[model samples]
Target: MVMETIEKVIVNLGASDIDSRLEELLIDGILYAFQEQIMNDDANVMLNEFGIVVNALGQRVKPYLPHICGTIK
Candidate 1:
């Protein structure tokens, strides 16, 4: 529920409008949630929301690629 709301907000705001520090914090929180929920069957919705947030960030996501890829792997 919260993740969905966050995804919507990010999509509406767009990447450029997000402050770097806040973006970093958001990414960190999403990544943490993903890692924690990876093994949970009910995590699909949250995972989807995380993906949308990542996609919405666009190029701003570059710096976190290694961490993101590592998490996905």
Candidate 2:
């Protein structure tokens, strides 16, 4: 399924866009990991430079990212 999405993105947006969106994807993944408390300090460094991931290894990491988290309404 992920491959299919990647293929679609590459076909629709071109392979050149992949590198440009890499940072967005990384930030999204890191945000998800932080929200789920599943990421460790050794595994994340991109946001650490900004002190955005202060509790990466904590049992309950915070969700301070700007993106919206969908929920049943």
Candidate 3:
């Protein structure tokens, strides 16, 4: 399912969006981990970084989509 979604996103968005989408995917995993509240400072830091990157990606992509899109939404 993930691969199929990736294919669809790739087809809809240009090459530049791939990096943002990839980061978005990774951030989802991190956010899940954080939401589950798995203990560990290192894990928290990693998740925080993922959130930061995801935010930046969203800032970049929001102008294009300008609506609900990507893993964050």
Candidate 4:
């Protein structure tokens, strides 16, 4: 499901002329991967590391994600 969303977002970004959309999809992919890793017991260590990285990266990407995702519209 997450991959699908990423693929769709990437496709949309490629088809559209929007830099924000590209940024949004890139962020979403990072978030989705983090979520998936955190949900698995075997990935607990990775999850912790990713949490810090995502938090730092997310701050930079959060602003444009909603517009590209269309979740608010």
Q: Answer with 1 or 3, whichever has the higher TM-score.
A: 1
Runs in model 3 with CA error above 4 Å?
A: 1-24, 58-73
Q: Cα RMSD (Å) per model?
A: 2.0, 12.6, 9.3, 9.5
Ranking by TM-score: 1, 3, 4, 2
TM-score of 3: 0.34
Query: Which number leads on lDDT?
Result: 1
Candidate 3 has its poorest 10 consecutive residues by lDDT at 64-73
**Compared with the true structure, what per-residue lDDT tens digits does model 1 show for residues 1-73?**
5687897887787667788999999989887877776457647887788788888888888999999889867
**Candidate 4 lDDT, 1-73, residue by residue in tens:** 4444544554454423435665566556555565455355535554444344334444555564564345312
Best by TM-score: 1
lDDT of 3 by residue, 1-73 (tens): 3333443454466336456566556545554644555456555464445444445455564443422234224
- Model 1 clash pairs? none
User: Which residue pairs in candidate 3 collide?
Assistant: none
Q: Global CA lDDT of candidate 1, please?
A: 0.81
lDDT of each: 0.81, 0.38, 0.48, 0.48
Report model 4's TM-score to 2 decimal places.
Answer: 0.32
Off by over 4 Å in 1: none
Q: How accurate is candidate 2 locally (lDDT)?
A: 0.38
Q: Quote the lDDT for 64 in model 3.
A: 39
Give the TM-score of each candidate: 0.79, 0.30, 0.34, 0.32
Which ranges in model 4 have alpha carbons more than 4 Å from their true place? 1-18, 38-73
